[model samples]
Target: MAILDYANPTRFLRLTQIVLPWLTAACLAAFAVGLYMTFFVSPEDYQQGQTVKIMYIHVPAAWLCMMTYSIMAISSLGTLVWKHPLADVSAKAAAPIGAAFTLIALITGSLWGRPMWGTYWEWDARMTSVLVLLIMYLGLIALWRTMEDPIRAGKAAAVLTLVGAINLPIIKFSVEWWNTLHQPASVMRMDGPTIDTSMLVPLFVMAGAATLLFFVLHLQAMRNEILRRRVRAMRLKAAAGSRAARMAPPSSPLSSPMSGTPGAAE
Candidate 1:
């Protein structure tokens, strides 16, 4: 019910206005703490040495990349069924952010891989699926930009998002399903994480920071998009009013005191 109600632009804007500052503060604080712990407190990897520090950035960014896509997919579904205005806003705002995180994940993964695996990249299952996910984000963004109509673009993007969602499972299970250079699950396994405590804290902290940052950024983008829609509506209305005024016939007017003639202007 609240979700439907917040589909109203003004309502969403007002809510974000109240929440955004706090979220931004939390993101900054978490990021600072996460970075400090990652560099200072965490032990260097026995095998990869200091290069393993890349995991702090790489793992969190990877999580965010997937989380953002999931958000886009859910928002698209909302747009399709609930017809929520902010759903489209959410999807549009999320695409580029997700892509950026995916890029970070790829770059950092490569850095880590070069040191540990002795190669910059491998056409492994996990790597390939992650690459495909990034491409999907790019495609969604391209579609949105190429289309003229906002509603139509949103619908098209939504469809693309849904289609791309199939890759998420593939990316998730790729390590388990095939032999790969990419490491198997660490934090997610039912038997508990394989990572030691010193490294784990930084990873979790970084994940929290990334999650906070995403919401803060998402809210800001949505607010800007809503304002854009408002401006467009106002411009369209003004244009319609000008056209109507031009189409209207000239009319006789009452005499003004300043003018000593019939049909004088005020």
Candidate 2:
């Protein structure tokens, strides 16, 4: 299948080179339009006023925070179950990006919360779980770096990623399961979004833009990872070759003048 072809690093690199330009352009265009809508078109919330606009950035970052990890989790499965060649590269590259998004979500949430909740932070379920998600992201990044061998690192990180996945559901349903300062599903609901269309349109537009941004970033990161791995492999091969050359036994030469004894007459 076409997807399987990408397991080959060469093919993947080619695809990335072709796709990245388009993705970048789309991402930039979406962000431009989304920002304009967020600041100008969407009216201020009656309840939160201008502070509510923070939702545009906060919500999208949070979505990416979780979405990036979800991608990693799937990649982990690819590494362990399917043994796809680039699976580890994909997972490794995504960790830092996910962490960045998580950090953004946390900071923005705190800023938004200070005005609404009268506190910068609380130990409530939703907040705490998100904090846990951030910590998990940090831990995974550390795990990858701590291991020298990519193959081994990937396998180990894959297990940890899968284990950490338990938190995803917890973060999502934390509000419903327990008391929390954070509000429950206003936009993502079974009955459809509760927010007014005016605001919803902007939110969805921003979400689309953010999603595009993630792909642009994700693909770029994957390319870098692939190149890094190639460099590493080359170095290893060079080191091995040098070591072999050093250890090889020296060659011996037969005397051309063995002759002296047999041909005495000169």
Candidate 3:
């Protein structure tokens, strides 16, 4: 399978090399369109005024926060179950990026909330759950650093990541499960989007751009990780060789100076 062939790091790197330029172009184009629409075309909320524009980016970042973690969780599964060589690389690369998105969501949410909620923060179910997600991201990153061996680190982090996944559903349903300042889903529903079409269009555009950006970043990070592992292996092999040379006993040749006629053995 084309996808399975990429299980090899070399193949995966080749795929990234070929696709990254196009992905970057598309991502930039989407962002340009999304931003223009957000600033010029989209209407402001009657109640929140221009503050509503924050939703364009806030919503996308929030989605990415969850989506990135989902990727990590799936990659973790790949590591523990499938033994895919690139799985840990994927998972490791996604963690920091996910954390960045989560942080963006929190900051933007706070800025948006101050105008709408009359405060920057509330220890509400939705907000708290997102905070927990950020903490988990940081923890997984630390776990990776704590272990020197990639395989062992990947397995350990994989288990922890899966454990943290329980929080995701809680984060999603928190507003519904409990009374919270965070609003319920507006666009993502079976009944269809509640927002007007004008606003929804740009929102979707922004979300798509954000998703593309994530993949671009993810792929680049994976390539770097694969190369990093290769370098580590080479360094270890060199160290082993040096140690072997040091441990080897020194030997004298049979035709040494002491055995010659000038200094023959007595």
Show where candidate 3 strays beyond 4 Å.
Answer: 1-7, 170-192, 249-266
Query: Candidate 3, after superposition: displacement of residue 46 in Å?
Result: 1.1
- Measured with C-alpha atoms, the lDDT of residue 87 in candidate 1 is 92
Worst 10 residues of 1 by lDDT: 183-192
Candidate 2 residue lDDT tens string, 1-266: 43464459888899899999999999899999989999989999777889879999988898898899999999999999999988888999999999898888889988988898788885556566778888898999999999999989999999999988865686658654665345443321212365788888888888889899888988899999988988997898687656655766434534354343321221
Residues 61-143, model 3: lDDT tens digits = 98999999989999999999998888999999999999999999999988887877778986655567788889899999999
**Model 2 worst lDDT window (10 residues):** 257-266
Q: Which candidate gets the maximum lDDT versus the true structure?
A: 3
Q: Rate the local accuracy (lDDT) of all candidates.
A: 0.82, 0.82, 0.84
RMSD of each predicted structure: 8.0, 10.0, 9.1
Alpha carbon lDDT of residue 243, candidate 2? 65
Judging by lDDT, tell me the better candidate of 1 and 3: 3
lDDT of 1: 0.82
Using lDDT as the measure, name the better of candidate 2 and candidate 3: 3
Model 3 weakest 10-residue run by lDDT:
257-266
